[model samples]
Target: MASKERKTPLIRVKNLYKVFGPNAGKVLQQVKEGKSKDDILAETGHTVGLSDINMDIYPGEIFVVMGLSGSGKSTLIRHFNRLIDPTAGVIEVEGSDVMSFDDKALQQFRRHKMSMVFQRFGLMPHRSVLDNIGYGLQIQGVAKQEREKLARYWLETVGLDGYDKHFPANLSGGQQQRVGLARALCTDADILLMDEAFSALDPLIRSEMQDQLIELQEKLHKTIVFITHDLDEALRLGDRIAILRDGVLVQQGEPVDILLHPADDYVEAFVKDVNRARALTVETVMKPQVCRISAETIGEALAEMRKSKDDYGYYINEDGYQGVITQETLEGVEQSEYDKAIDPSLLDSVPAVHTDALLEAVIPETLDSEHPLPVINADGDVEGRLSRSTLAEVLSDQAGSEEDDEKVKKLKTSKSLAA
Candidate 1:
């Protein structure tokens, strides 16, 4: 993981406020004094678009801004590039004041420092895929050959390699969005502002685009500001999430932090709908090792593990974790070899998870692993273990199901246990 302490803010907003009306300046004090949005609207005919929003966007992190309609999520992203000026507050990009930028400076900043991918797949209808992807570079006066080269590279990066000449009119929604992503990427901008970038596609395609974005972010590490109303999308993509409601900044934190501890009733209501097992870290339910086998020889460990009837067993050397041993491997060792020095190859490898990983990420690996999943920490040392019962109980509990016993009995086929 990147060390956050060493990173500086790429963008900073302090006491940001955006209100819409001729009397915005006059009504600002009322809103600041804790007047309700409706009362302010009734008295001054003004609508608050954002309220004292403050956050520091770190370098190379995906910062998600999410909210329902009229939450000012869209309005907030527009302030990043000064597309919508704030009613009152600071908007700084790269330590420079964005609100202070003149027309020319703002234009230059928009052209070179930032790029946006819209939910509507804003590709040029008449332009070919290659031309559309290179459109930003073209505007920057890049030569056609060089710009096309950059475009083609990002085209392949986004998995739209052979569809270079196809127009947006001919491509599917997903393909068009891919082109839009590539267009933003080709410019090599420092920050990407994506407003509901994948909300227009079908479920499967939307999921595919989300995965594609994750893979791209892993390789490129560009600082991204993603706007979405979907909690799932925000949890999936955001390194840190900021939720807005009625133009109020309700909460901001890491995904797991938000999921584990919501800031208020509004935030709690949002989390109640998420799949707890899918969003929670492995460490949430991981427990101490259930069965440990310590022996002077490999054969002794194997014999002890057989009594447990589990397919996998933990091997301890001097009462410390060595690795998980398999029942299948133990069956082949001859009695005479019991006294020999332990071989590293004798330890069986099974499915493992990091303590910080979401439980959903390890479920697939566990399907073929009848043994418990060992949870390791950042130092690659065994910290705890996750058993089938715990997983089933957590899942059933999250569902608020009364049939936990039935779920446990059926977990074998439902992928709670390893093979």
Candidate 2:
């Protein structure tokens, strides 16, 4: 989801390269000169973990890094808190160079600025859930009573309140994972680095955890860097996705941009089977196709609406959510309501959907409201109007396509049997 605001990046990486072997620094220049990972490994026995990687991660957004195993996604995330130092490059957080931190600065940074949730739910089997959650704060020298109180708040926040006395061994996998999540939150860090955090959960549990992350993000708005090999998970959680292949960044952009316009065959194939209705944002299905017009340009906006044959449009201005206008309201009960902003007196306000919100969210908003929904961006400025008919068409078409694909597969199997 693209926000219109020009907020400064919380983290920035420039010309980042990582080499796994002992001769990493020597081979780093070869990588920068466009050498392949395989070539670098074959010649000098140096494994290229990342090559010329540059990215900007904004505050209060989930930035997902994904690739198949060996793509170096995990390696890239490690360098954020200097878990794995880069062979060469600049790593900056809030304008401070991460690579320059001394041991004490690094330890404090890891304790107060960043926390990681591991794939295997790294928990202390001997420690109770409450103690485990408070482990981070305890390390920071917080008093036992105060740390427990904060831990208890996060435990309840993650819906594990009554299980405080339980040990990691006594809980199910999902419960243990939730405890890990609670522990991370209890630290109250500014950034969270989750490396395949929910990859080990069963499908239902995975979905539940994903929902928890999304719901929590709505209120917490912490800057999160998530890693996964699963494309579906990437689509569901990423505010912007960066894809890697063989230690190189193949593509990086908003999920909708990745879906509607892949940068290459690799990205295209990755998204080929995705369910658009589920992954698509409200902006894609919003009326008139084009979006983000000004309130003063009601004439052009109205013309575009008529061209697309939609009844409603939003009169968006810099201040945001000005009003919604209908065709009848715009026609003005007279000659063409010529080139001017629609009368604010004739407009009505309705519930708004952020342009980055999934189309699935639009259905409920539409059901609860009588008028077409207003679509907005991060700054709460009106971006477009999402119509009920448009959302239905998107969902219906996807469902129909899947049904047809299943029927065709069945028919092919029947023919094989007859032969």
Candidate 3:
């Protein structure tokens, strides 16, 4: 894992606000004075687009802003590239204060350093795909030949190699969005601002586009500010997610961390239905030094695992850890030839997860499957096994912890009432 100190933040937003009203200044004054939420809402009738927001976006990180329609996710994203100027507070991009830049400076900043992709595929109907992708480079006075070369490279990069001559109007919705992505990427800007960029596509195409974007980001390592209302998309794409509610930043962290330890009721509700186990892996939840096993007889394996009193057993291969066969699996199976005929490819099951996955993710896979799964490290060595009982223990602990917290809260409330 990379050390946090080694990663420099590429963008920073501090105490940002964007209230829209004639008396926005006075409204902000009231907000800063620590008025109650209802009082502030009643006084100016000013919608707080963003309130006292503070965050750091690391270089090469796909930082996602997620929320509902009026959550200020869009407004917050706009502030990064200066699409919408903040009413008060500071926004720094690449160590420069964006709010202080003059019109010419800001224009130059956007043209050279930043690019945006909108939910609607913004493309010219009459212009060819090449023209649209090359538009930014052309505006910056690059030679037509040079820009066209760059555009062609991006078109190919975005999987639209032969569609350069086609007009946007002729393209499908997904294809048009690809053109938009290519256009944003063609500028070779250091920062990419995507505002619900894949929302318009059908679910299948949207997933395809997400995969494409992940592949591209892995290769390019561009710093991206992605905005979306879809929690699943945010969780899937974001290295770190910032959840906004009524313009206030509710929570921010890696997806697993956020899901496992939501900071508020709102965030908990947002991720309540998410299949966390799939998102997490065995590596995150496995206990250390658990019993090890070989891909031999089930009776022998069950006896050894039971001796260790562990829920799961790790199967070792000539190379390293191969798979896991648990007691649950052994108990559930009836003596059959099919069990003996288990494919040798079973040894090649999906690689085990590191100890970093959230319980929400690790639990489901263990429960859903008939066999215990191996938890592997980055080097493909089997670290341990994660099984159904382990998952149950995690869920039970979570529930117990919540109950304890509630008791603590109630105790505090009662004490305060007596005082």
Q: Which candidate is the best by lDDT?
A: 1
For candidate 2, give the lDDT: 0.82
Clash count of each predicted structure: 2, 0, 12
lDDT of 2 by residue, 193-278 (tens): 99999999999999999999999998898999999999999988998999999999999988877877789998878888877757
The TM-score of predicted model 2 comes to 0.76
Compose the digit string of candidate 3's lDDT tens values, residues 215-331: 999889898999999988987888889999888898998776787789999998998876654455455457564668764665666667778777766667567765655667666
When summed lDDT is taken over every stretch of 10 residues in candidate 2, the lowest stretch is 410-419
Which residue runs does candidate 2 get wrong by more than 4 Å? 1-4, 285-357, 360-419
Per-prediction TM-score to the true structure, in the order listed: 0.80, 0.76, 0.77
Ranking by TM-score: 1, 3, 2
Better of 1 and 2 by lDDT: 1
Give every collision pair in model 1: 369-418, 370-418
Each model's lDDT:
0.84, 0.82, 0.77
What candidate 3 gets wrong by more than 4 Å, as runs, is 1-6, 36-41, 283-318, 322-373, 382-385, 393-419
- TM-score of candidate 1 against the unseen true structure: 0.80
lDDT of 1: 0.84
Greater TM-score among 2 and 3 belongs to 3
